[model samples]
Target: MNNIKIKKNFSPKTYLHKYVYDDIRPIIKKKRKKVKSCDFKIVEPENYKNIVCINYNVNQLKQMCKRYKLKVSGNKSELMYRIYNFLKYSYYCIKIQKNYRGYLYRQYEKFKGPGYKNTKLCCNKTDFLLFEEIKNLPKKQLFTYKDKDGFIYGFDICSLWNLIYLNKETKNPYNRNQFPEDMLYKIKRIVHIGNIYNYDINIEVDKSDLDILSNKKKIELKTLEIFQKIDKFGHITNISWFLNLSKIKLFSFLRELIDIWNYRAQITMETKKNIFPPSGSPFNNINFMILRHKKIEYIQEKMLRLINRLITYGKNEEYCKLGALYILGALTMVNNNAANALPWLYDSFMIVS
Candidate 1:
């Protein structure tokens, strides 16, 4: 946006103990003055006629927008923040905003008290997953019709051998500075655990947790060890890589694109359903952990609620494991409740989500 810059020195700005993401209310809230209106004609409670937005009205916001030539299409919250940005920063950064209340509170220790110790969202566990950084494949290249040997080479995949990366520039470098928001490609959560969209799995994980992944479903990390294709002229025709992972799933956004006049990201089939992950063998059961909170009600974790409803209400075992012919999940809510509350709740998974 021409008028605003939310990032300072290649990093997101923090205001009011919260990360500013197109929302400037926190800054304004911090600056709000509790002033009393100096009017004898009308008796009022403290700060009845303050200039701050603590006492807000639609007309005031509109007037501010008109006076500043700001866009008037946003909701009141958006407009309030926009005007605040204009007044304070003299610019308006219009980015997709995410809810950071939970995170900010945790950072500030808002949830810490005598009753609560080792809480899930309030703390970070030491045992987080550690993902190996798979090198990014080279930027796609067009097929060379003829090489020095006069042999035809229409693709280049062989150079994938030296999969070592000294420094890289394939994916957006600074985007992680804005993680879980500006996602290019990431593995969704599987095995009934974690947020489906959380790709921040590059940390070291516990071995027991790793076993859960292996038992549920794994592409076998060994399979990703060797991947290469050389053209007839000893030229690199195509390249492939595992860009990032969420536990078991290794995800790559773009493969070495094959240039057939234009470019199309290649998906070499280990089998027919080349791009999509194949389903595990049938009759494999999926179960979640169930536990009771200290002297509190029992709450089951994972999809127990849904599974129970489907089982009892539907009235059939077949319905319990019915046709998803292929379960393609775009959005999933795999949360932990009291039932699955291990000594550590999802190992601070809820907070990460």
Candidate 2:
């Protein structure tokens, strides 16, 4: 048996080359993040180092030629290069020629999808025309340009979303456990409480009135007064006014006031948490830090002090008004200077008479 002699040749240069290639290849490796559910396949170039030609889906190539202000027929390679350059320069991320082809394919796919995403109409159309007009217009005509009056004319779309989004506050009335009468009384208490602070607002209920006409007329008059106040001064203001008055005649105003206060309180809470869109000004790139625990602790201390004062001299005419004022003031501070605060304070002071 003749044994075949085999030579195992391992060289230092071969090992060194392997290591160098491994280290350097990573620098030139594909960088694009893998896009999910992309319609186009990435086809790599065989001859050129980093170039690729993309075969279009249907009339996509024709569309591309049209897009770059070119005729749809002939000079295919030049049109392809134009498309490549457009993507590379415009997006700034599509550096490789293959990346440009893949992007165009993806955009074409998206344009043809059920809901066209990121696809702009041609410059001739109404939407695009209007956009161009706005873009070229002087800064004075624009809504929120820095050179303009700094007033944004449009609604905060997010705010409108929140305002109309949900009806979470409407409690279920059909539940056997939920007593409508009890809820009604609680609402009535809130009304009474408000009226005690604002004596002038209360409806006049004469003890001498036994006639049905007089009683009916008194109720009607009181209802009109409350409605008028609500129309003039908003819910929170009316509630504060009611709370400040003496409980003279609050028939239906009390219910409306309670509902309004509850709504406002919820709104204030939402605003503080940034759950609701801002009602004031446009958001700017401003930075500020607030220590939440520190603020809450400080406010809690003030609230406790006010509660103690209210408990101590709530009955005495002189101190009663003062205590009410203090409580309202503290609540106002806790609510972050909400607009309703002043009304509450004013109503409390009105009952000093």
Candidate 2 local distance difference test against the native: 0.31
- The residue-by-residue lDDT of candidate 1 on 189-230, one tens digit each, is 111112223322222334575566542222222111111111
Q: Report backbone clashes per prediction.
A: 18, 13
Q: Which candidate ranks first by lDDT, i.e. highest?
A: 2
Supply candidate 1's per-residue lDDT for 82.
60
Alpha-carbon runs more than 4 Å astray in model 1: 1-22, 25-53, 91-353
Cα RMSD to the true fold for all candidates: 27.6, 27.3
TM-score of 2: 0.17
Model 2 Cα lDDT, one tens digit per residue, 88-156:
343433345457556644543332222122122211111111222323332211111011222212111
Error of 2 at 112 (Å): 35
Q: How do the predictions measure up, each by TM-score?
A: 0.15, 0.17
